[model samples]
Target: MSARSGPRRPAGLGATTRAGLKPAIFVTLVSVLAVVVAAIASAPFRSSTNVESLLFQMAPLLLVAAGQATVILIAGIDLSVGSMMSLATVLAASGSAFGNSAVAVVAVVLLVGAIGGLANGLGVLSGVNPLVMTLATMAVFRGVALLVLGQPGGSVPSGLLTPLTNVYGHVPLPFVVALVAIVLLWFATAETRWGRSLYATGADERHAASAGLPVRRTILTAYLVAGLFAALGGLALVARIYSGDPLVGDPFALDSITAALIGGIAVTGGRGSVLAVVPAVLLLSLTDNLLNLFGVFSYWQYVAKGVILIVTLWGYHAAGSPSGLLAMARSGWRARDARAARGTKA
Candidate 1:
């Protein structure tokens, strides 16, 4: 071998970084495409109100998906978010006299949500499968929410609206919240030791435990975070509609999970980012907004949304897998070689 010949040190990290980025990049492209298509199909989408409306609608889904991604990153799932949100709305609206202080109301709602989430973690730790445990909790929470409201006519304090939904002086409240959630979640997953432990535990529980990582604590933390965010979604709803409705958050269970998956948060666990879910949520919002502008029926929108999710998940598996990435690398190598050979002949 030549004296200077050696394996490139950065090459391995480069390959892994590229591989890790594939899903997020794909989702970003898809989001851009969705926006462009929406703009083209519906001229009204270019209007300021319409554009800002999309941002407002994107916030709740972003929060729920962010929370779900955290739990999924630890190889667990929370099926109770929809119910959690519903319960939050009910609690905030069920005449809980906090004496004109929305802060007090918010604190109580958040606390209850964290408690519910902790219960889910406990149930899982007690040998119950998360699928079953969270599902049961969902039913229980939904029943409690119903009992709290019995219907959808409870009143929410109007003062809470501004903090939750107001776009004042060029700064949208919901957008600010979304940005904060993205930054915090990203930092936790990418820059912190706990984040590393989350991935390790999700990747393989036995290995994570053998390595002396606190796998159970990580999972518990994920659930607590998920619950808190779910309640925040309810708070957003109160700001928007200013009333409690039991059914308001029912679709979030499926929608949030779909957003996380489409956002590049792999359902297989240990491999995805919360940052990706933000744009994924935008894609969904744009799709729905454009469909509405085009006079599409709600039923058709549901079908279209399902199709989009299925296709995105298929793409994730196809282009984000090890074999798929290896194939891409080989293709690049062949092209490079072909270019070099042509140059030599020239």
Candidate 2:
């Protein structure tokens, strides 16, 4: 037994430190703080009814974040998610006007989403950078949505909105649906071979391909999954608002990315879990709700959200130096040796 083998100061402290400083933890903490502040500031804000309303408002955002997480996990980003959502909302509303057949509305919405996703897949696989491609598609899709809707508004049938917006026996249906989807996604990423391949490809596409993974196919599938989720979010939005506006999803692109980042999804990819995103979505939604309750200006909300994102990201990088962990480790080792020599001379 050597000094190195002597009793250690238990791993619990390190584990606790890591957990407490995690990005998800920070998001949760900030969220709790915001809620507490909001409750104290406003007497009517502490009720269960308010909580339900907040969850209800967050449903679409949570759905979009779920989809965005998949795309980001694959080392890609989809700027067109918001535009696709807008298109879906318009399509669903139009379909409802024709016959009010829920199936028809759903099919049209999903079809548009799939087509938008296919465009993204083809662009990426064909050598276009994802940022440029999605950015272009974002403009195109938004334009198309504007052309279709010709304006900001269209009504969705009450039959559709009621069930979707219902809190089933005090349980919000949208929240429940989102929860189930998150669980399924968590399992898919954790237990499936495809999930492993996805992470491998995101970490290193060349190496993943050399290892016989179908990199292109995986990326394409990831984008498709993103599109599907965006469509679901769009549908939910229409249901909740009982109308579809051409600009309904304009804010979602930034909000979804912010949520995913806050949730601990690595921008560089291959270092996050879907479970981390749940708290992130809730945190953002709660912030928005509290601000609304206080009658804060919407423009100020956007500015505050942007500031929060920048600060959180800076803190995340500074905390672990994750981006330069290896380099920092080498420098620390050298500094430690220099200190040891100086100590011996003293």
Top candidate, metric TM-score: 1
Off by over 4 Å in 2: 1-23, 96-98, 169-171, 295-297, 318-346
Best lDDT among the predictions, by candidate number = 1
lDDT of 2 at 168: 71
Q: lDDT per residue, candidate 2, 235-339, as tens digits?
A: 878756677778889889988888887776666555466666787787777767777778988777777777777666666666652321222343353453353
Lowest lDDT 10-mer window, candidate 2? 1-10
The CA lDDT of each predicted structure is 0.74, 0.72
TM-score to true structure, per model: 0.85, 0.81
